[model samples]
Every structure is written in C-alpha cells, then in structure tokens.
Target: MIGLIGGMSWESSAEYYRILNQGIRERHGQTASARCLLWSFDFAEIEELQHRGDWVSLEALMIDAARRLEAGGAEVLLICTNTMHKMADAVQSAVGVPLLHIADATAEAVKTANITRVGLLGTAFTMEQDFYKGRLARHHGLDVIIPDAADRSTIHRIIYEELVAGQALPASRDAYRAIIARLVDDGAEAIILGCTEIMLLVRPEDSAVPLFDTTALHANAAISMALAD
Candidate 1:
C-alpha cells in the first residue's frame, strides 16, 4: 500500500489521488488500483506555520503524519506537495516506509527526455530555496532556470490566489505562456511545472517547450515502485 501525506492544498492532493488510481488501473488492468492510505492536512494550518517560518514545528507535524500512515499499514510514503517536500527527510526518518522524493522522479523524467536545462514555475519558497532545485542539480546534474523577480512574484501570486482557490483565469494562463516563451528563448529546453497545482493551469499546449508535470511523474513513480520486484 502507498501512503499519501497531502492536502497542502486540497486541489493538488485531490489530483494526485485521482491520477494515482487512474494510472494504477491502467497499468495493472481493469479494477486494479493502488491501495493508498491518505492523510490529508489542513492547508490553512500548514500555511500559517510556513508563513511563520516555523520549520521545527512543521517537520514535527509531517513526521507525525508519516508515522500514522506507517502504523496504519502503508508500505510506502509520498508527500503530495512540491513545496512541502522540504520536510521529506524528517518525515522519512520518522516512518519505516520508503518515502519517494518528487524531485528525483521529475529529474529522471527530464533526463529521459535528454534535456539538461528547464524553466521552473512554482511557489516562492520552492523557487528561492535549494531544497528542490539543489536536489535536482546534485542527483541529475540538471540546470534549472526560474523567472525574474517580477515574473516570480506574478507566478507565485497566481498559484496561491487563483490555482489554489480553484480559479483559472485566461489572463493568468497568458502570463504563464509569456514567461515560458521567454524562458525557451533564453535556452531552456523545457519547463518544469514545479508546483503540483501549476499543472492545473499550464498544459503542454501552452508551451513551445515540453512541460514536465511533477505530480504525474511522482504519482507514476509511486505506482511503479508499489508494483516492482
């Protein structure tokens, strides 16, 4: 069974849940789906902790969640948010189940496409920090490109205000397309939908470059591991 630590935003986590089941059934034939244990948290509470810069308490909360999943018989663990993956190490250590890193999964997908440089779009924390990008550099030797300050601010704003809120504006989609065009012109071979919810807005057709949806890659990786020898 796979364990899911989700609800960083109910939207993203819900998509992960649907995709995981859909992919599993497709892979193993009719009625064959992943047996998953989902422990979804309150996004408001988690966001409050993040805004306060309380890493210790945040880690503790996630660790507790992972422990609960493991104790309840989940064999593998998944953190359903891109930004919250910063706490992955702590949670993995506290639980007996193997926790899959979303960045690793995305990196492998990028490498398979033979692309070394990609533009990334996500929350401000994910863009400014090394946790996700650093892991990609260290593990896959890929160069990640992010938007400029103004673009980052706009991207971050749209992600939280629009995407998380279950609203998709045509203007927001155009903004993302403009950013992707600039990134591709600046030599990015592809774009990484770094935030899970970002994929909810930006589709492959929106970019001249290929779009790598981390949520799909991560979910597919989990199903592969769950069924692997």
Candidate 2:
C-alpha cells in the first residue's frame, strides 16, 4: 500500500490521486486497485509557512503525517507536491516507511532517456532553492537549467495565479512554450516540468525537447512499487 501526502493546492493533488488509481486499474484486472492511505493538509496553512520561512514548523507537520500513514499500514509514502519535498528527508527520517523522492524518480527516467542536461520550471521556492536541483545534480549527476530572474518570476506566477487555480490560459501556454524554446536553444536536451502543476500548461506536444512530467513519472514509480511483489 502507498500513503499519499497531498492537498498542496489540491489541484495537482487531485491529479496524483487520479493517476495513481488509474494506473492501478489499467495494470490489474477490472475492480482491482492497490490499497492506499491518504493524508491531505490545508494548503493555505502550508503556504503560509513557506512565506514565513518556517521550515521547522513545516517539518513537524510532515513528520506527523508520515507517522499517521505508517500506522495505517502504508508500506511507502509519497509527497504529491514538488515544493513541499524540501522537507522530504526530515519526514523520511521520522517515519517508519520509505518515502519515494520525486526528484530521484524523475532522474531515473532522465537517465533512461540518456539526457544529461535538462531545464526545470517549478514554484519559485523549488526553482530558487538548492534542494530540488541540487539533489538532481548531486545524486543523479545531471545538469539542471532554470530560466533567468524575469522568466523564473513569470513561470512561478503562472503556476500559482493560473495553474493552481485550475486555470490554463492560451497566453500562459504560449509564454511557457517561449521559455522552453529558449532553454532548448541554451542546450537543454529535455524539459523537466518540475512543478506538479506545470504539465497542465506545457506538455510534450508543445515542446521541441522531450518533456519529463514529474507528476506522471512519480505516479508511475509509486504504482510500480505498489504492484511489485
């Protein structure tokens, strides 16, 4: 069984839930699905913690969630949001079950594709903080590229103001495509949709370089683990 810690904006969390269960149904026979445990948080409170730079408080909440899931018989834990993964290590340390790192899963996918340099687009914290990109580089030996200050701000704004609000405008899509084009010109072999909500605005069909949808990749990894004997 898998434990999902979600509700970071709820939109992308819904996608994670849907994709995980759908993968189960498709892989197994009809009416067959993996046993799962879920713990959702009030995203408003979590976001507040981020703005306040209160990681100590944030880590406490996550550790508590992990413990609850472990007690509920979850074999593994998955944090559905990319930004929240900044606390992943602490949560894993405090919990009994294994926590699947999203960046690790995406890096494995990138390795399979033989891509060494990739562009990333995610929330401001995910992009600016060393946690996500550093992990990809330190652990996976891949080069990570991000947009400049202005473009990074634009991408971050679109994620929160538009995508997380369940809005995907054509203008937002075009803006994202332009950003990806610049990254491709700068030698990006693939584009990592680092933000869980980013795949909603930009997709493989719209990009010249291959698009690594982190949400999809993470979901596949979880399903693979859950179904494996």
Candidate 3:
C-alpha cells in the first residue's frame, strides 16, 4: 500500500487523492479505492518552515509522518507538494518505506514525450534548488531550463499567495504564457509545469509550445507502480 504525505498545500493534495483513487477504480474493475495511509500536515507550519529555509526541521516533520505510515503498513510514500520535494532525499532516507521521486517520474514522462530541453515552471525554491534539476539530469539525461529572475518571481507569487489559496485568475494564465514563450525562444522544446497548480494556470492550448503537466504525469506513474506486482 502507498502512504500519501500530503497537505503541503491542501489544494494540490486534494488533486492527488482524487486522481489516485479514480485511477485505481478505473483500472482495477472495482468500486473500491487504492489502499492508502494518509498523514496530512498543517498548512501554516509547512509554509512557515518553508519560508524560513528550515528544511532540516521540515524533514523531521515528514520523517515522523513516514514513520506513522510505516507503522500503519505502507510500503511506499508519496509527498504531494512539488516545492516541499526540495527535502526529498532527507525525507526518503529517514523513512522506512521507499519514497517515490515526483520529479524523476515526471522526467520519465518527458523521456516518452521525447523532449530534450524542457522549460521548468515551479516555486522559486524548486527552480533555484539543485535537488530536482540534478535528479532529472542524472537520472534521465534531460536538460532542464528555468525562467529568468523576474518571471520566476511572478510564477512563484502566483503559486503560493494565489493558486494554492484556490484563486485562479486569467492574468495568472497570461503570465505563464509569457514565460513559456520566453522558454521557447531559449530553445526549450517543451515546458514542464513543474508546479502542480501550474496546470490550472497555463495549459498546452494557451501556448504554442507543448506543456507537460507534472501532476498528471506523476499521478500516472504512481498508478502504474501501484498496479504493478
């Protein structure tokens, strides 16, 4: 069984829960859902820890969550937030169950999409951090391209103070489109919506460049692994 360590932003976690259960019901020929042990954390604490760069303390929180899930009989763990994945290695190492790397899963999807250079749009911390980018390059041989400072700030603000709070405006969509255009000019064959909430803003239809939704790709990977023997 899988344990979902969610609630980094309840909005995206809701998506994970829905998509995972829906994928299970659709593929397994049952009205039942996938067996999951969930541990949801407080948003305020998570946000505070993130903003202060208190990643070590943050890892401890997730480690405790993983231990709870382990005791509850989960074989694997999935962290629902992309930004919080900055501490993925530390959390994975502390936990008893195997932690699935969402970025790696998305990178695998990018491989199937056959895109060599892909634009990455996510929280400022994620874009700035080497954890996600290093994994994508080392594990998949893909070049990860990120937005410039201004565009990065714009996208980051839109995600935390806006999208994650459940507000989706058209202006936010346009901002992402502009970023995608810049990425294309920079030689990006496609854009990876590295932030789960990003798909709600910019979609493939809005951009001339191909847009890969990280949430969908990650969900598909989890489903595939869960269904496999």
The deviation in Å at residue 224 for candidate 1 is 0.2
Which is the better candidate, 1 or 3, if ranked by lDDT?
A: 1
Global lDDT of each model?
0.90, 0.91, 0.84
TM-score quality measure for candidate 3: 0.95
In candidate 2, list every pair of residues with a backbone clash. none
Q: Write the per-residue lDDT of candidate 2 for residues 1-229, one digit (tens) a residue.
A: 9999988878888888888888988988778776888899998899889889999999999999999999999998999989989999999999877899999999999999999999998988998999999999999999999998999999988987888788999999999999999999999999999999887778788899899999999988999988784
Residue-level lDDT tens digits of model 1 in 149-177: 99999999998788987888999999999
Query: Per-residue alpha-carbon lDDT of model 3 for 12-110, expressed as tens digits?
Result: 778888888899999876787888877999888998888998988998888888889888998878888788788888888887768888998888778
Candidate 3 lDDT at 197 equals 82
Measured on C-alpha atoms, candidate 3 has an lDDT of 0.84
Worst 10 residues of 2 by lDDT: 29-38
